[model samples]
Target: VTVCCVAADPPAEAWVKGGPVDPNLLGATTRSFLAKVLTSLMDRFEQDDDKDTVAAAGEALAQLAMLLGGPGVHSVTQRLIDTCLQLLQQEHICQSSDDELDGEEDHDGALWEAVSELLM
Candidate 1:
């Protein structure tokens, strides 16, 4: 399945002459395959109605961050931050009360911690 694909190493035949070549029969590189997996997980995190499934997706994201290393994790987190910041800057985020701001702060704090851990 997708998880197995994401966890797999790229095939030896996937590279040639010290460069990436089309390994048509072989599959995608780890990074490329995992990107799809991460995107699917993120989509499910937002769209899934089942609490357990959503929770698992969230955990999967943390595990993926660990697997991806600093630069890759930064790429993922930066996309998240950019999306959130865009919502805030574009006034897409509703500020109905003080509680909303508090919630936003909580999310921001957690995101910062995740990024810091990835960097370290």
Candidate 2:
């Protein structure tokens, strides 16, 4: 995951407006690899119980979306918004419950902070 994030950082600017690498820059093989990476990240984001892992996956997803710059950006943006809304709902439920939330709130708060940063 860390490796993927690092690898994506360098090519980010290239995919932006007026840059050399456009949507057509990637070959079939590279596109296939990116698809696999995106799938894996989405899976981790949805299934991971650890808040830190989920937050990292969310950041990676945002980075990958920017690097790809195509129809995928819209889909990924919507997905991230949906995920954040779900997380917010879960946090509300947790707060309303009687269970102890001292540590849980901290974890959720950090995750929310990270997701907020990515969205910005």
Number of backbone collisions per candidate: 0, 0
Stretches off by above 4 angstroms in model 2 are 1-13, 17-29, 66-75, 91-101
Score residue 22 of candidate 2 by CA lDDT: 45
* Root-mean-square deviation of candidate 2: 5.1
Per-candidate RMSD, Å? 7.7, 5.1
Q: Could you tell me every candidate's TM-score relative to the true structure?
A: 0.41, 0.57
Identify the leading candidate in terms of lDDT. 2
Candidate 1 lDDT score relative to the true structure: 0.47
Q: Given candidate 1, what's the lDDT at residue 92?
A: 23
Task: State the C-alpha lDDT per candidate.
Answer: 0.47, 0.60
In terms of TM-score, the best-performing candidate is 2
lDDT of 1 by residue, 61-83 (tens): 66655444332334456654553
| Candidate 2 local lDDT, residue 54 | 81
